[model samples]
Target: MGYGELIIRSYDPQYDRTRVEDFERKCEVGPAKRVFLFTDTLGDPICRIRNSPIYKMLVAELGNQLVGVIQGSIKLVTVHKPPNDLAKVGYILGLRVSSLYRRRGIGSSLVIKLEEWFIANDVDYAYMATEKDNKASVKLFVDRLSYVKFQTPTILVNPVSHRMSRISSNVELAKLKVEEAEAIYRKFMSSTEFFPIDIGNILRNKLSLGTWAAYPRGESWSGVPSSWAMLSVWNSGELFKLRLGNAPLSCLMYTKSSRLIEKLVPCVKLPCIPDFFRPFGFYFIYGVYREGPLSGKLVRTLCRFVHNMASKSKDCKVIVTEVGGSDTSRLHIPHWKSLSCPEDLWCIKALKNEKKNSLHELTKTPPTRALFVDPREV
Candidate 1:
């Protein structure tokens, strides 16, 4: 069927659940892995985004065949620039078109339809992310449409080690009541990109374990933090896992060798896991912010604390988080010797007149600066 024949509609549980999931499964893949073998709620479209009012799921159908799917949400985002602007924007994600139906404008059509959804909701700015090397996606977002590659971000992952290190004695990390966390976020992180206006609700969500903040070991203050920083831990272990059955033949041949390479480059902390391995249990820390000259220490302490918490758990084995490379705050997160984890590219476009002055040329590689997009938003 032609692109014109494709029907784009909001996801319907009764009629579209299975087909929509199949399309998503067909699209989900690791950089090296051929397929994702296990089925779990992690990344499950229906379970994750289906119920939220802001979240919308759409699928493209042609003659009873599901060809593509996309999901997005409308949110009020904070811009770091002067005026520390607040914008009603659209965050688009999980855009996928079946391989057989691609190159015929199906993906583009899905995007256009979603753009309509954004405009109708009074959102003029839209943004999304993809791996740095996803050339086809780059072309689709930048060339076909007028999107700019704004930031490059790394996904930092630390495995739960058997023997965990202690968080610095200077840092008295305490779990904050949701109310306290919300207040701190407003004071310190409000200018952060994609900082949610309803931060309290986000912290209290089922998937969220809790939010913690760091204060000097001895301090008595209320309202806004003097040099406060906070981060929220997300329970992703319950979300999903990578199944062993999905391992490619190359994975089998390289597992032992890859392990050796990883050990040799331990300082780099490179991700060389065999595609066949299962990612059973993990925690991801997000909504991190800190102030002061030693704020980076607070960031590192938070990461270590979260990783240690996972290490203490019987089922958990990994800890992960993403930060915009342009974000100087990420320097506070641990990385060394220029060998870092995979850095993802974030691109954005303006549906109306909002971002014309702000958007830059994709070909222009500017110096990295501060960029912050809440991981939950993506």
Candidate 2:
């Protein structure tokens, strides 16, 4: 595709939906032979980014076909500085190019156009996340686009079992009212990197199932627990379906035998892996904030609580969450090593260096608080 023939414009849902979906189907994500991942936007290509305060989707057209698409959203987020030091940060995601038009600069053109929009909006910085092993993506962003590798977060995935995992009786879990949740988050997470300033809106969003806190039993209800953990669940499955492809024979057998054993013996407590070969939805755990000396236990209990809740849902096959590689809470969150990825790369670029914190300073600074993974970006 020639640069002159390619036209980049804002996506129009009326005529672009079907074409976008078609292009998505033709494009394969993830590594060959290891995993083939499919992301179903459930008919709305923009559903994932629509929840952000400011979002836009753009499409690249070569003649009559939608060959490429990219989405970007801007939000006021806390940076690696003093508490409440907020900056206009833009997030880039859902970049796709048609398989037939590879290496012809469609992907690059789409991203360049999106970054232009981010700069025009006065975005201080922009970042994106992708699998560390995605060489093409790494080259496009890190080498070609001048983005720096900032953070390597792990995607923690725990399969929702048929049987519920038990939480310790010593831990007391309570659902926090919207106001209560908002107040707690504002107090504790304001210093965390990428912490949204409009967290009140996130907690109150309809997709936010709710927020819950877990602490030791017999703690005073009025006061904060000495050792406690809090998290909010977002109904991401409602917006997209993730399908696992290229399953190995061993995995297939394990899933089958586990199901058969469960059917034959009702009392058996086998860890049954759900049928992931088909399309399935998932719950995203965000705002994984904890404090106190015994917060690890509280984090595990909260994870089990979310697991039990997911077991009741027909479509929810797995519980997924991401935390920084250095985040200590990763030691407590329950996840299968085989299913979870150890590193998801985040590449960032400074749109402008007029601010007090330069791009180099931001990259060199060590994270002081746990990363607050914004659910809207998930």
Candidate 2: segments with Cα more than 4 A from true spot: 1-4, 82-84, 266-269, 355-357
State the TM-score for model 2.
0.95
Q: Cα deviation of 274 in candidate 2 (Å)?
A: 0.9
The lDDT values for all models are 0.68, 0.88
Clashes of each: 2, 0
Task: Give lDDT tens digits, candidate 2, residues 1-378.
Answer: 253599999999999998887777666667546668788888998998999999999999878877889999999988876364778999999998887788988898999899899999999999999999889999999989899988899899999986878889999999999999988887887877778989999999999999999999999657867888999999899888888777788888999999999999969887788999888999999989899999999999999999999999999999999998899899999999988889999989988867435778888888655888999998
In candidate 1, what are the lDDT values of residues 1-71, reduced to their tens digit?
34447788998878876666666655654333354444344546555443244878888888788988888
* TM-score (C-alpha, index-matched) for candidate 1: 0.80
- Residue 333 lDDT (model 1): 68
Score every model by TM-score.
0.80, 0.95
Instruction: For model 1, give the RMSD to the true fold.
Output: 5.0
Top candidate on TM-score is 2
